[model samples]
Target: MFSDRFDQLVQALRILPSVGPKSAQRMALHMIMKNREGAIGLAQALTEATDHIHECTICHSLTEDDVCHICSSHERDDELLCVVESPADVMAIEQSGSFRGKYHVLGGHLSPLDGIGPEEIGIPYLIQRLSQGKVKEVILATNATVEGQATAHYLVEASKHLPLHITRIAQGVPQGGELEYVDSHTLSQAVHNRMRMK
Candidate 1:
């Protein structure tokens, strides 16, 4: 239905999450017709970000440096840790400006069907961090998805021996909500209304 280059562009766009073939085609054609400059800028930005971003050594959040700004900031509370499923979750929390603690990015959630396990997403590292003695509380900020809940439970079990308070963000978030998609006010409210796991 389109030229080889256009078809290739659509296929590439389709690789993005939730972007079906129709949407991808629409985007490709839009780029070709309406917003060529913006499209070029977007492509360049994507390439640059992909090339420069590296995982933070301490928290696994994306950063250009070895450590992310949040990890390096002395203003944040080192005794509080927010465990999230990805860097995007960290960003969502940051946008809310409600949390002034450190973060630990899990990289991904626990999904048995997808074969992602504790070892696959650096849960061991988080346990090790908790063992270091300064952390007082851990906020489970993973998404409200099933896999996210499973990951949170795994973390709770793993940190059982540690002298730390573990809590999960509240559920003002709609079902099937991703942290990245949640608005700042809702995310902030969730953090403020966090509850301890029974």
Candidate 2:
């Protein structure tokens, strides 16, 4: 219904997650008609980012350098390592302003059905890093999904022989969530993890 370039742009925009054909078409039209300058900047930024950004050699987080800022920061606790599923998780944790340690990104969780295993996610390499004896404690910050739990369990089993202390992040209801609206499993977990006020 549009020019070849316009159709191609719409198609490309549709490749973004959760973007439908109509939304993609709207975005293409808006960019071309109202935001051509911003669109050019966006295109240039995407090109530059794709050309320079890469996985950090130490933590596997996205960085323009060989090692990410988090990994290279001497102020961060090297003895306390937080293991996460992805760079996005790392970003979330960083924004929380709570944790003050280094991180090890797993790249992904273990999904047997999907053929994602320990080696596929570089779990063995994680174990190797833990075995270096510098890190004393590891906090598992993977998501609370079944696959995430399975991956955490696998890590626990794999590191059983090591002297490092392993801990899973507590799961419970969100801060503003009401009990009636919360799922039974999360409520149960919240009850189970309830703290004493004495």
Candidate 3:
């Protein structure tokens, strides 16, 4: 219920996840009235980030370079690879300071209803990477949701013949919990106490 420009701004704001129409409208108004400078800065940052950030060629994580920092780091353990649903999960695990290994982001979990299967989430690519023989262990760090569990199990089955040790992050994270919302301590514990999935 506003001018075309205002409505357009609200709609743009609504593109953010979980932002409803009303919340978007409120945000638009707040930015226009109370924080125009911040809004401009945010706009510039968003444009720059969107223009420059691309997926890391190796791990599929958001990065401005061909390889992400974690993937290029020499100090990190190359033999240990952590599989996660998204780059956000990688950030969560990094913040925990419990894992010093490389990562493979699946982008999403398998959801048959959504028609997202192994091929859609790059499972074959992961298997190809595993086949290189540099990695010795893989940690399944997907969320605790049913879809996450199913995806992890599928990965286990898909890589059964590979000469690699597969493990799932242990309990501590509540059922249905996503890594992004979990505390550092809990995530650290989960990483430290992971269980074999074989």
Candidate 4:
């Protein structure tokens, strides 16, 4: 068994997603014994990031600024809006460099049992934005999961009268797959081959 501080470090490391107790302990040991400087840098970066990072006002994506670059950019297509479940999905799509449109991050998908509903994930705000009529196309880029599909369908129904073209990314993303884990080429192709849902 290690000291209290070491145990605390391991516990803290375990706070990261998918990090188990053994992995946390190993990471703690590596940070303390082999990469103390690197660990310190990582700690500072995390602290600074947490201190500054906040959601973009327009798209609900993580950004240090009030508005994300994509939302504010003039070169990006203002008529095309890609709706994603999380900021990670936004990052994945951006990394793919396929879609030249703006984005609307839903924050999360619909989960009735979990009590996550339309208002809970900023769907009303999305409808408001769409109602403004700046965006002509709405790409339902939510993950391929059941909840994601439900959310997309709900959005389609919710904004049926908005007079905007609603489309869904191609099925190349695989069934029940999250966007963040999908490969760039696959994401690109999916965006390219998107089908109209409305």
Candidate 5:
């Protein structure tokens, strides 16, 4: 129905997550017809970001420099290291304002079925970093999924020799969640990890 260039633009837009053919077509039309300047700016920004952004050498988080701002900041506690699965997780933790510790992004969790293992997610490097004795505590903040739990357990086993105090992030019902709506696994975890309040 449209020109080759328009179809190409729609296809390009469809590359974004959750965007289908119709949505991509709508986006393409909106960009070309209503938001040409905004579209151009978006294109330039995407190009610049892709060119500049890279993994931080220290923690494997996304950054424009060798080390991310969080890893380089002296204000954060060096003794507390939070291990996460991705840069997005790091962003989530930062937004929560609950933690003031260093981070280690594993890039991904263990998935043996997908051939992802310890080496693939830089587990060895994490152990090496922990072995240096700078971090007194290591918080396993990976997702609560099976893969994430396995990765956390593997890290615990690997670092058993070290004198570090390792802990997993609590998993359970959300702040506004009701018991009836929660899943069995989550409810079980909530019960098992119940805190004693005096």
Candidate 6:
């Protein structure tokens, strides 16, 4: 319903997560009308960031440097590892300021139907990290969704024999809510009130 250029913009916008055709059109028009320069800057930033960013070798979080800030920081506890589904979760935890441990980004949760299994999401890497005998505790900070729960259970079962204490981040994170969307206060409380899984 738009010109070729406008349609191209809409198509590009639709590739983003949670953006539908209507939203893509609305955003495209909004950018075109409100501030074209700002829109161009946004596009440039996206391009530059995506091109420059690479996964942190130690944690798998997006970073321009070889190691992420958390992995390199002396302030973070090396003996505690927080296992999260994505980098966004790391940011949320960091923002809450409740955890001072390093993180291991799983890349994503296990979804057999989607062909995302243990190997695909770096579960083996996690086991290897545990085998090194540095980390003492692993906080299963995956989301509360079915896939997240399944991933957490799998990790717990797999690492049962290892010399590490496994704990899951508390629930009560509003049903269908994500870590990135939860407020800092609620996230802090959840981290503080985390319970050991039986």
Q: How well is each residue in 1-92 modelled by candidate 4, as lDDT tens digits? A: 57998988898998899999999989999989999999999999999999999999999998899998988999999999999999999999
TM-score, predicted candidate 5 vs. hidden true structure: 0.98
lDDT of 6 at 40: 85
TM-score of each: 0.79, 0.98, 0.83, 0.85, 0.98, 0.81
10-113, model 1: which lDDT tens digit per residue?
Answer: 98998899999889989999999999999999999999999999999999999999999989999999999999998889999999999999999999998878
Candidates 2 and 4, the one with greater TM-score: 2
Q: Model 5 over residues 1-198: C-alpha lDDT tens digits?
A: 479999889889988999999999889999899999999999999999999999999999999999999999999999999999999999999999999999999999999999998999999999999989899999999998888899999999999999999998888899999999999989998999899998
* CA RMSD of all predictions: 6.5, 0.8, 6.2, 6.1, 0.8, 6.3
Encode model 3's per-residue lDDT on 1-198: one tens digit a residue. 669999999999988999999899899999999999999999999999999999999999999999999999999999999999999999999999999999999999999999998999999999999999999999999998889999999999999999999999876787899999999888997898777899
Q: How well does candidate 1 match the true structure in TM-score terms? A: 0.79
The global C-alpha lDDT for each of the candidates, from Candidate 1 onward, is 0.91, 0.95, 0.95, 0.93, 0.94, 0.92
Spell out the clash pairs found in candidate 5: none
**Residue 190 lDDT (model 4):** 86
True-structure lDDT of candidate 2: 0.95
* lDDT of the structure predicted as candidate 6: 0.92
Which regions of candidate 5 fall more than 4 Å away from where they truly are? none
On a 0 to 100 scale, what is the lDDT of residue 28 in model 1?
Answer: 93
Q: Which parts of model 4 have CA positions greater than 4 angstroms off?
A: 172-198
